[model samples]
Structure formats: C-alpha cells, structure tokens
Target chain A: MNFAQPVYYPKADYIETDTGNKVSRRATIAGPQNIILGGKTIISSTAIIRGDLRRTGPGHAVVISLGKYCLISEGCILRPPYKTYRGNFNYYPMKIGDHVHIGANTVVEAAMIGNYVEIGKNCIIGKFTMIKDCAKIADNTVIPPNTVVPALVLFSGSPGQFVENLPESTQELFESQTKQYYNRFQPLEG
Target chain B: MAPIKDRFTIHSKAVVCQDVDLRGEITIGSGTVVHPKATIFAITGPIVIGANCIIEEAVIIINRKKEVMRIGDENLFEIGCRVECPSIGDFNTISTRARVHYTLRLTSYCVIGAGCLVVLPEEEVLEEHTVIYGPASERRVWSGRGHIQELDLRRKHSEYLRETLPKFNRLRRGDGA
Candidate 1:
C-alpha cells in the first residue's frame, strides 16, 4: 500500500512461459489460449493483447503469434485483423518474427512483421500490411493498410511511407537490444 | 477488467464499465456512461463529472490541480482522449486521441478534434464553440450544430450505452460496482 520502497517483488513481476517468455502481471492478455508467444519475449504492463479476437470455429488457429525475443511495450495493442468476408466478419492471424520490438502505445494490426523489425512509439501499423525484415518505423508513424514495407527500410510520418534503407547492421542492433531488454525486465526487489 | 475500486461516488443511474481504473476522490453524475478501460485518476484533486456524459473506451480524465476538476453536463469524450484539465464546461466533445493538458479551461461547445494536443499555457479559456484540430492545436472557427443538439445526441448515446453496457458489467451506485 505504500509508494515508497517500491523496489520489491513479492512474487514474480511476470509469469514465465514454458518457452521462457515473460508477460507482465499488469498487461491485459485476453484469451491467452489463442496467443503464441515465443521464448524470451517481453510484454510490458498496460499492453493489450486481444487474443479473443480470433477466427471463429478455430482449431490450431493462432490469432497472434510473436516470435522469440520480441518486445511489446506499454499501452501497445496487438489485435488480429478483422474483415467482412462472405457476409460475416472474420479475423485473420497476426504474425511477428523473431527479435522484433514494438514501441510504447503502438497499435499493430498488421498481417505480418518479419524478423528484426523495430517500431517506434505511438505508431499505428495499419491492418493487413506486410513489413519485411530489418525494417524501422519511427515514432507517431501511421502506416496505411495493405501497404508493403520492404526489407531493411525506415518509415516515418503520419501515413507511414518508406524513408530510407536501414543500416545493414540493423539486425545486429535489434538482436542486442532484445536481449538487453529481456534481461533488464525483471521484478524489483528490496 | 480490474476489481471495483473503493472511494468512488457514482450515481445510481451512472453506467461505469468493468475496466475503469480509479484511484482517488472521484464522482460521476447520473446517466453517465463510462466505457471500458477509461481511467479517472483524482490523486491530486477531486474529479466530478456531471450528468449524461459519455466517456468512450480508453478515455483518461485526470485531475492534477489544487482545485477540483469540475466537468459539466453532456460532455462526450470519444475513444482514447486524454483530459488532464482543471475544469471542463458543458457540451464539450473531446474527439479520439486528443490530449488536453493541465489547467486549460474548456468552455461550452468546444470540439477537440482527433489527435490534437492542446497545451496552451497562456490561454485559460477555449471560448464558446471553438474547435482545436490537428497535432499543432490549430484553432479553427466552430460551425454546424448547436450545443443543445450536441448535448441531446450525447445524452441519447449515453442512454443507449447504459442499457447495452450493463449486460457485460455489473453496475451499482457506489464505487465498488
């Protein structure tokens, strides 16, 4: 009940998945049965994962699948894409590859994100977009739906478009940062 | 949704959703519909919302002043709008994703457009029917419908919301709903 001396973790701050992923206690993880988080992934507090928004009548249908060492920051929302097909609203799967980091308050409904992608804060990744590997999306960018972001490019703006090609070392940076974030994300102890 | 918090004074007719996070002294008037994930923090000062207000999903109203953050009747805060103002008058519509900073006095019939950030330190009052749109707080002349019309629309929406939302979340007069 006290604010001071807050450096204490009574239990674990996050629940460790069988694959070594960590999901914060404060994060809203709905219908976890539909979500597949790879090992070493970190989902921060206040993030919302709408795993319940999966395709209806599903067996082995993964609504949201995050690869290993991915980081989802605070207030981000990860929702599968929904579309009206054949007179009914159907949700599609969302897939993210390894070593990807989505920044704070970003909302991602993208169909696919390749490995080593880094999205900055306050981005709105439009539904059904295809983001290739080693891509970097800057803060406050809004990518239009169905837009394809080619590999190793930087995108930034209200409606996100290609800004420049990413450094060849972009993958290395993401790998290091993902591991660093995973290690730093721990329950406080007093 | 988090558990029903303590120290909240909600009217019997107020419809607060399941996931609202309240911390300090907060009060809501009758016929107000607060949707899921709406956060009302009154740690520094009390926040009193007037009647027939519709607070949509993820709307955050915080009071960070020495005085009470008084909100008047028929205010409609759309999805993801952040209100940290000292006082907001009647019939104000804060559109989606707009941020109203601390101590700004929003008068009646002001429409804050989507994604706008309003943080004018000098201007205390957003005069009658003024609209703030765009990320740079571009002040534009207000037009179209009157405040009465706006208030009626919001009230009707709130009425509809009360019936539909109660099906999902338990509603009570007290704080612990």
Candidate 2:
C-alpha cells in the first residue's frame, strides 16, 4: 500500500480504450512507473504487481511486461525472481505473452510465460520458471524454481507433472473466450 | 494512563508505517517492519510480535474473541493473507492470500503454502518442519530443518522495503538503516 490513503473509486470502474486494458482500482501495483502492458488486458481487484523490486545495479530495466489479451484475476501476485550474482542480489525482468489467463490467488514469480497459456486458481509458479506457449496448468499446481513447462500440455499436482495434450481447438477457444470476457467485463452502465 | 490508551504500546526499533490501522494493545518487536495499509486489530487481548518479522501490505491479522495472540521471530506474512491464528512459532512462511484460522500452536519450520486454508482442529497438532499445502490439503512432514533460503528472501525483501518504502510512506520508528 502507498502512502496516499485510497479514496472511493467510481463504482462502475475504469477501462483504457486504446490498449483496451481494464485495471481495478483495488489492485496493488507497486512501481507503476516500471510496468508496461499490452492491449486488451484485465487486471482484477487484489492483483499485486511488484515492479518496485527491480534489478540491483543501475540502468532502466523493464520489470514486468505483458502482451495483449491477458487476464490476471483476484489475489494474484506477479513478481520477478531474485538471485544473488557477484555478491549482489538482483531481481530480473519478467515477460508474459498474449492470451494468458491467470486464475485467482496464484503467486507467479516466473521469468517468462509464453502465449495462449491458462493457469488455474491457487497455483504457485516458482521463480525463474519458464512456461512455453499454449500450456494449461490445472488448479493447485506448484511449479518449482528454474523449472521449464513445455507447450500445449496439461499439467497438475505438486511439482507440476504433465498430464495430457490439449485439444486442437485450444487456441481458437482461448482467443474467442478472452475476447468475450473483455467485452463482458462491464461494471453495469448507469 | 487510561485503560483504552494503555493498550497500544510500540516498543523500540519497530518500524510501523503510517498507513497501518492498529487497534488495541499491539506490541511490535524490535527489527520488525509492518508495511503500509496492514490492518491489525486486537479484539481479545494483547498481540505481541517477535523481532525480525516482516508483515507485508494488505495483511489482516485479527485476534477476534480470543485471549491472546503471539507471533514469533523471523516470520514472513505475505501480501493479502488473512490470519486469525493465536500462537505462531518461529520461521513459518505464511504465503500470499493464505488463511490460517484458530491455530493452537504452529511448530517451527512449517511452510503454509500460498492460498492454503489452514483451519486447525482443537485436537490437531502441527509437527515441526510440516509443509501444509494444495487445494486437496496434503500434509508433508519432514525431519530436517526448514528452508533457510526462503526465509532469507523475506529478509532481503524487508531490506528492500526499508530502503524504498519510506520514500513513499511515512515510517514511524527505527528499523532499517
């Protein structure tokens, strides 16, 4: 929480037009100065993005960057992984690709998340973990640090074991469904 | 001192941010950092916190209808976690958004996973180095010590917050350099 006491936001909420990004006022985004978002993204209430934890050394490093058509649900924390290098512990940058939907209460500290991925609720994606494109992580999945998840595979359980291959229609389905959600995420027009 | 005013006493070397909502007798231990917007309400009795603990933002720690609440040293209460536990042992990692309710005694080196709902029964007793996690509520007991690396991360985070957060929020007392 910042120093400024949060006032009452509009009941209906806010949405960006050009990028089509919808961010809830209740979301705690630390260092909004460093975050970059692509078009048509939805960040729900209670989502936390820790951009304040940046690299140790100087130079303007991008903390977190998201691609188009992403949805971050409630109580999710998006933070970069930290590691000690040359006697200095630094937090590297984190990048996410397009059409990703991260479900509620998920703690993500991954280095890179690929496109068309869907992560379910209450999952923990550990630091420096790289997720390839079109993966589906089931609910309560725990992917350990430095782990790599391949594309188009369904994964579950602790330590995130692969379960099954996704359907052929997965890409089309996610694209269309996320578009629908973005269109339907209105706060009830007055 | 009046009874209502005597309940709130902040000890030395405790850094509580100006934005915190504290009600009743809450004793903050030395080297502990309570971040901004952390709401801690003591309804039953006094709440005592040990040293070197970090309480992050939006964390609601309430002692409702209970006798006393005591938190241990070197513990990390992550963001958005709702805790109503009575006695918490040292070095426990209560992760993000995890709800711990009515815990009698949590042994040391226990790692409660993120988003886990831990409601301990009166008869249940948590062993040391117990990792409680998953939506299915799996319990994994270990004989060895806890993850010192994970605890170290919190210290690093607290150090970072100590350097950075005061630039944004108004800090109350002595904490980090």
Candidate 3:
C-alpha cells in the first residue's frame, strides 16, 4: 500500500467544515441539508452524494448518514436505495458506519454499510444490499441486489460471492488505515 | 476553430440541475430529470431526449455524428454511465458505469447491466428486451413479457425526482420552455 506517500490536493478545491469534514468543490453533493456527515470524513473530487432522493411526503428526512473517518474516493457515487412499499415508491435512507473506505469510481446503492469495511475500486454495490462490519469487497466486484454480506469475510467476483474469511485484526487495521489516509490527505503548502 | 452554438430546448416541467454540462443543440422533453454533473455534448449533431428520462450524475451522452441522436421516454441512465449511441428507444435502463459505444442503436426494454461495455461493430442495433450483463459481457433475450412494472417504477422515480430535486438544488432555467 502507498500509505506512506502523502497525497496533496489544491487547498482551493475543498471546503473544510467545522467538523473536520473535507468536501471537494467538484463533488456533486445534492441536498447538503439532508446529508449527515460525521467528523473527519473526506469526500474527494468527482464524488456524488445524492442526498436529494429522500423519502417522499410530509416533514424532513435524512437521506444519507455517514459516520466518522470515512473516505469517499474520487468519482464514487453514493445513492440511497429506493423501493416500492404499499404501491407507493419511496427512497430509504443510507447508513454508513465509521472507518469505511470506499475506493475510487465505486457506485454504492447499499442500504447499510457497517463499520471498518473496505470496498475496493470500480465496484458496483447493488440496491438495498447490506454489508456488515469488517467486510472487504474486492475491486471490480458487482454485488447483486438485496444481498447480505456478513462480517469478517472477503467478497469478490462479478456476482460477489464470499471468497474467504478475513483476519480477526481487520477492524483495527481498517481503522488505522482510514485514519492514516485522512491525515495524509493534505493540501500543498505555499 | 469556430465557436459552437448553444441551442437547448427544455420543456418547462423538466428538472435540469444547474451544474449539468450541456453543449451544442439539445432538446429535452417534459418530465426529464437531469442530475448534477451529467454531461450532454452534441458536438456534430442535435440530441433529442424524450419525456420522463432520468439522467443520473456523471452520465456522459456524446453525439459526435452529423445525424441527430434521439432517445425515447422512460429511460434510466444511471450514475457514471457513458452513452455515445446514435438512437435509443423507450424503457431502457443503462446501469452504473456501463458504456454504450457510438455505433450501436438501442431499442425498447433493453437492460445494460452494471459495468458492461457494449462495443459492437459499426451500425449494429440492439434488439428489444435484450439483457446484457455479467463480467464476460453476456447477451441474452429476456423471455418475460413487457416490463410494465419496471417502466412504471421508472416513471414514478422520475416524477419523484422532478418534484423533489428543485426543492433542494438550483435549477437551470431560460434554456427550456
């Protein structure tokens, strides 16, 4: 891993919120009011968070709730899953736990992603899929709709079957890696 | 190089986000919901999209040929999909990160699966209800009857977005009716 290399971005391209969430200017974040971001999350350029697809009718609703120290990489699209209930179509909120690292160009439509999960590049997480804690989804994996990925396993391939069990220390490893990635993502000094 | 003319005709009921990148001549029919960061580049032709289409974020539709590129109603272009096809019929779903090359013509009820790349020979046409999916880019004919439920769901999705998106994001006006 290129963990030691510090990735520098232009300071003008990002807006750093008070909660230490770094959101890129080029990222298309629709309905910022409906998105709840925990502290120290990094939303890279070209990442699209569709918070506007909230639940229909009456009162306000939270569309996407992301936890702390998450890394949404470049070109990643995060859209909440939607389905028809009682003959009326509605969108459900997406919940993502802490220390989750979503790789570049991955389109995630999952209902929930648990803590310390690492999803690799170019993966398509289908609608309403549930990924539990400490799971590792390999690059280019296409998970089918309504699939449940249990904890501590590595999922790969087009249909995204379980490949093998992950190490017990995966949670610690992912937490440290995500924290390190957030720290190393800095702007070049003048 | 000559400056390209910007001519867009969007219906008043269409909800196009302000951040969408549109160039050259384009016509968007009513009830189309174009999300932010979607790009429609008509470099050498006029592109016409029919009613109730959902153009999701980061979708790039480029028309480089001299002939007009037309797209029918109730089509769903999901996030990060690229389409350079000549013409497309109704009720098509192009899933996330799929690429349809310029030489193909797509018909109604065709489902292009996620991450699939359709790069057929020149002037090739995709038949109706053709489902292209999997890592090997498998092709199959869907034996089910007309996708009435799916199309109805798509229409509902588009309607919901049209009603909800403008409430949260800035709309691009003055280019459409």
First chain TM-score in every candidate? 0.90, 0.90, 0.97
Candidate 3 scores a C-alpha RMSD against the true structure in Å of 2.0
Worst 10 residues of 1 chain B by lDDT: B167-176
List model 3 lDDT by residue over A78-118, tens digit each. 99998888879899999999999999999999999999999
Q: In CAPRI terms, where does candidate 1 land?
A: incorrect
What are the DockQ scores of the candidates, in order? 0.07, 0.23, 0.79
Taking every candidate in turn, the Cα RMSD to the unseen true structure, in Å, is 7.8, 6.4, 2.0
* Candidate closest to the true structure, highest lDDT: 3
Candidate 3 CAPRI classification by DockQ = medium
Interface RMSD of each: 6.9, 3.1, 0.9
Candidate 3: the clashing residue pairs are B10-B176
Model 1 lDDT, residue B6, Cα: 48
DockQ of 3: 0.79
Global Cα lDDT for candidate 3: 0.92
lDDT of 1 by residue, A1-45 (tens): 222332223346677778878788999776677788889988888
Q: Residue B143 CA error for candidate 3 (Å)?
A: 1.9
Off by over 4 Å in 2: A1-12, A15-17, A186-189, B1-21, B35-37, B123-154, B168-177
lDDT of each: 0.79, 0.79, 0.92
